[model samples]
Target: MPRYNMYYPDYEKLYPGIEKRPDILRVLRASDRKMRYMEKGLKLERSVWDRKKQTIASLPSREISLEELMEDGRQQFSNGPTLDEQVQHQEELRHLHQALCSLEREYQLLLYFRYWKDMSQEDVAKMLSLTQQAVSYRERYALQRLKDFVQNGEKKKF
Candidate 1:
């Protein structure tokens, strides 16, 4: 009967007597906030994807001769990132690398494996010889450290 069934389906089955427990209610509210945040992000991403698809679909679909292709190739590819944008992106990567380097070796390796190598948390745990829970904890701590470092203008050491 709760209005939040759209967000937390089967809420009664998942958290019986939730209304009687303030602690569980608080946790559920926090979870709802996180879910809403993620849902907004997903919506934004989907919108961008749809816009890109529409733009692509709206392009002319006529066939071009070899001479036309040769003549327009340079102009057609000139819409890439500008030099300033490329430089800025490189600088951002450098800043991120510095932040990553400031973390402890274990945290660095954990992030590298989990993100750079696209490994799952369970796989990372097996590789690092740690429990999944421990890996999860460390991953969260490490990301928080990186976020703090970046937010502090990347001047502070971890």
Candidate 2:
């Protein structure tokens, strides 16, 4: 446990658990992570107090400056749930893989040629030896069905 002297220059300012006392904290224990997190708001001064006299002294409290720490990128509370988001993206890819696998061979080929191969409708028609109109209609219908299937599968939570 390390002691910290809370230096609030504005004596009129309000802070809990310290309003009635001489602003200096006798003993404060913060975890290593939390200590690091609050590093900017902490301060060290050799002459801030006289331990033998049990009296308060002076040192600026600049430990854990919000603006500085935020810029420095050491704030734990600032982190987002990126791990959860990455897991969610992987899960969606797995679901799409399964959905694609369940599609008919012709529909899968249509999608692969149009999207995966990045071919135009006319090119896809030429590759499949079908009319462009027929290719367009079937591709649109298949994509609609794929979207519906994916949405329904997501609703099922499986």
Please report the candidate that would top TM-score against the real structure: 1
User: lDDT of model 1 at residue 157?
Assistant: 58
Local distance difference test, candidate 2: 0.69
Q: Per-residue lDDT tens digits of candidate 1, residues 31-64?
A: 9877765555432222123565565323333444
Give the poorly placed runs of model 1, Cα more than 4 Å off: 1-77
lDDT of 2 by residue, 12-112 (tens): 24446574665353222234335565654456644566789998887655444677667887674735668889899999898888777767788789899
Q: In model 2, what is the error at residue 22, expressed in angstroms?
A: 28
Per-residue lDDT value at 128 in model 2: 89
Q: Which stretches of candidate 2 lie over 4 Å from their true place?
A: 1-62, 70-81, 154-158
Q: TM-score, each model?
A: 0.51, 0.50
User: lDDT, candidate 1, residue 11?
Assistant: 55
How large is the C-alpha RMSD of every model relative to the true structure?
Answer: 22.1, 13.7
